[model samples]
Target: MRITRMLGAAALLFGLTVTPAVADASPSPSASGDDSAPTSAGTSFRTATEVDQGQRATASASTGDYLYWSFPADAGQRPTVRATVKLPATHAAQTWQVDVYDGLRRRQSCQYGAQTRTAEQGSATVELACVLRTVRAWSEPWANDPLPGTYYIRLTALNLTTADLGQPVNASVRVGSKDIGGSAAVDGSLAKPLVPGIAVSSQSDSEDGDTSKAAVLSSIEPDGGWTSGWWSDRWVWTGIGAVLAALAGIGGYALTRGSGRPSRVPPGA
Candidate 1:
């Protein structure tokens, strides 16, 4: 009876300990959208017009054409952008690029990863991935800061070897936001202009100078990556290890209990 009671107590403890970890491990609901078909020059990031975060937009472009989209972001939020291009048979083997820009119109440096393949009948598909760092201000006063605001993504086709210069390729763009666990100094607004113009009113000379500097800083390089959110976090793997240990303990305890049972002898003996 004592052993049975001990086993019951252990089972209860296991339930209490593992339940919360499982809940914590569950994934948060992500914001996502898709654009099946996009129009030519469908949106402009220059005008601060962009698809909402967690949403996707599609468009068709040819050589020398640009497709743009914007999404809102906050400090400590890691934003990821992906672009996929589907080229027709005639547009195969062309070079393409995707660039990321911050609210100040500064060209942000990003880690880029791409894959290309020749499809059936000379068609090709290209996939591009760009991941932005947790938004934050620059440490130096003269350096360009990645503040909380609308970020833009530009997709362009570089060179076309095909004779059909007008041949259009379908492209899709997607943006995702993940919380890296920090607060920003300020929040961002979609209505705010990408580059604030110099103040004409009699404001402080310092304030006016700051605005002018930001406009010129738009050309600064960006910092970004190509990894997904799940792979970027360390705590997730720790939780997984804890759960596995608890399960192993329970299985071992059950086997020992079964082995301890007494065997029955035949009545004829």
Candidate 2:
């Protein structure tokens, strides 16, 4: 009876001690709101590999033309979108704009800025950056907050010189994200995979059977597979730790009971 009582006490003690430790060790979800981190990277639109966010690809565009790229983002992650446009010395000064949109095709307002004429020799470089805020889509119907999913970036050449018409201007873009303190509890798997946006001019190429032209404008690939909430991966490790702790407690209890037993005496004595 004493051994049984000791075993019961051991189990209870473990449950009281390890359970709270596990809970404390787990990360707590952040409150829903605009929890964006300070962004250092300037924004610009550039062609990049589907899997890589560092490598960039260059594209040439004429006046009044647009370039589009899509990137995946999760709630609580502050994603920064940037693009850089280089104008040749031969061309006159021009103005460009970068707009960000949500998965639902709704234009999301973001802080945008640009720096031009930073280079010498009459060449101009434009840099733009937008830092997104955390969004809770289900609760806030009136607010146009940024949510987790695929986001589209449209780069338009607002003002181009007449001499630069038909001349291709080089541009590059990249998207980066960092985890701010929060959790995307409301977000889940998307019903349909998000598709990358295509340039307006490239739309007619498909109908005209011009595969090459369409391919050029459709170079941006879809953002890879969906990512679960921040706590998803942590839960897995917590479960494994709990199981191991329970096994250790049981082994300790068994050894304690064995040690409490009286030693046997020899018959010859």
Candidate 3:
């Protein structure tokens, strides 16, 4: 009974240490917005218009112009960008494409979607969508896994007729996200999303200055810097390690303990 009680106590300690570390996490507050969001698109990444998830931004642009918009993404999110271009009636077919990039400026590959499409000469509009991989809490220094950060969506004409150059068109883009919950949770996170330019703002201090000019041409970091994430798998691992250590100590005591240790006496004594 005493040995059973010791085992029970060890099991109870393990449960307490491991469960809360993985279960008590709360995601950061997401950026919010309505349908009609941005009024214009940025000419360059430095000036990309800020848009929140579920918000749509539209602007009048030329066929070959690069239109840009940016949004915040958090860990465990799979963000999908959808774009529509209403081209003016033309005699030549046109190819349009939408590309997404992480805050590091590395172009992220779409999981699957109509990222590029050709609009028939008489077609009224061309639609494009790019689905990004789930945002990870952390990735290897060399790995390009999509981590939480500001993501950019660029819309442009890939192959348009020479005569269609400078032709006016209407462009719109929208962003949405699906959370992966605790399934994709990890033991680590970035100190900050790969956004450049602005100083890493702390909760106490707001910001530094426009330092990203040389790096990103423009900084589109979130209003407040990203939080380093709330929960981690390290807690669970640590608890498990402690439980093993304690169990080892208990087992060693049980095995090594005997009737008594001889004092200066012979075995026969």
CA lDDT of each prediction against the hidden true structure: 0.57, 0.54, 0.77
Q: Which portions of model 3 show Cα errors greater than 4 Å?
A: 1-36, 200-227, 232-269
| Alpha carbon lDDT at 173, candidate 2 | 68
Candidate 2, number of clashes: 12
Give per-residue CA lDDT, model 1, range 185-216, as digits (tens): 23332222233332321133456544444442
The prediction achieving the highest TM-score against the true structure is: 3
- Ranking under lDDT, best-scoring first? 3, 1, 2
**Residue-wise C-alpha lDDT for candidate 3, range 1-269, written one tens digit per residue:** 55677788888878877566445344334435554577799988888898877677889988889999888887766788989998897647998989999988789999999999999878999899998998888888899889888888899997667899999999988887775555667778887666644334332144445443334433444334464455545546666787778887887787688647765777775
State candidate 2's TM-score.
0.50
Q: Which pairs clash in model 3?
A: 46-218, 197-212
* Candidate with the larger lDDT of 1 and 2: 1
User: What local lDDT score does residue 127 receive in model 2, on the 0 to 100 scale?
Assistant: 77
